[model samples]
Target: MNQRALFAAAAATVLSSALLNMAPAAAQDMGKDMGKEKCYGIAKAGQNDCANLSGSHSCAGQAKTDMSKDEWKYVAKGTCKQMSGLTADEAKMSMTKKM
Candidate 1:
């Protein structure tokens, strides 16, 4: 193959590899958006994004109570309170109440 053709092939291979390597990171970042915030008392039972503040479980989808006060879910930035979800302070209050 011509030198130009060889160089083009090599560049294409490199670019494809780079894009494959970036796919997972991009997906993870999308899941954990920089502009989003974790809103407590919003996730239904078995719907939390991850572990709970109370340490009742260490994984997602393990919440024992619907809308548990200590659990959190990622919500868009500045939309947590507007969604009727609890702020950190309100969540704390709920934590003190009987489940």
Candidate 2:
């Protein structure tokens, strides 16, 4: 192959190899949260981890209010209550009582 073509192929191979090497580390970092627990009422506005309890939105970062009792974020397991957050059931009950 010409020098330019050879250089381009080498760069692509290096980039692909670097990305492949990063994939496992990225996956491992994600797995670190596997033991986390959902802590409701802790997420600030637009900072939730996933869907809200009320089903108003089906995606994360959609909370319109802070500590809404419906929004949640992942906290270390058993640390939810310590952070003054509620479980899904408790948040559901709280919302129910408010309505």
Candidate 3:
């Protein structure tokens, strides 16, 4: 195969592995005082405030402000898949670069 194609394949393989191994936290916490999807601490970026929990690296590439509520949901879903090493601050800025 060509060099470009080989590099692409390798990158895809690495991405697939990271995604396959990652686990996303739920929208609820064990404590009843916290609101639904709020206690988990993984807010939908600009949708709400969060203390910044651990998550995946791929989330660093997601967009911060979406056009609508539904779009935001998809954005958050993708962001949640990132590894535990990912930080909300890093993700917030990276996704906000476009707007």
Which number leads on TM-score?
A: 2
Q: What are the clashing pairs of model 3?
A: 55-83, 56-82, 56-83, 57-83
In model 1, which regions exceed 4 Å deviation?
A: 1-33, 97-99
**Candidate 2 per-residue C-alpha lDDT over 10-73 given as tens digits, one digit per residue, 9 for 90 to 100:** 9999998887666534543552568877788999999887678788975666899999899988
TM-score per model over all chains: 0.59, 0.66, 0.25
What does the lDDT read for residue 37 in candidate 3?
23
Is 1 or 2 the stronger prediction by TM-score? Answer: 2
lDDT of 3 by residue, 1-99 (tens): 999999999999999877644522221222224321222223345543312332222232242543212121222333444522233454555456645
Candidate 3 residue 79 C-alpha distance from true site, Å? 30
Pairs clashing in candidate 1? none
Compare candidates 1 and 2 on lDDT and give the better one. Answer: 2
Error of 3 at 59 (Å): 20
- What range of 10 consecutive residues in model 2 has the weakest lDDT sum? 23-32
**lDDT (CA) for every model shown?**
0.77, 0.81, 0.38
Candidates in order: C-alpha RMSD to true structure: 10.1, 8.2, 13.2
Off by over 4 Å in 3: 24-99
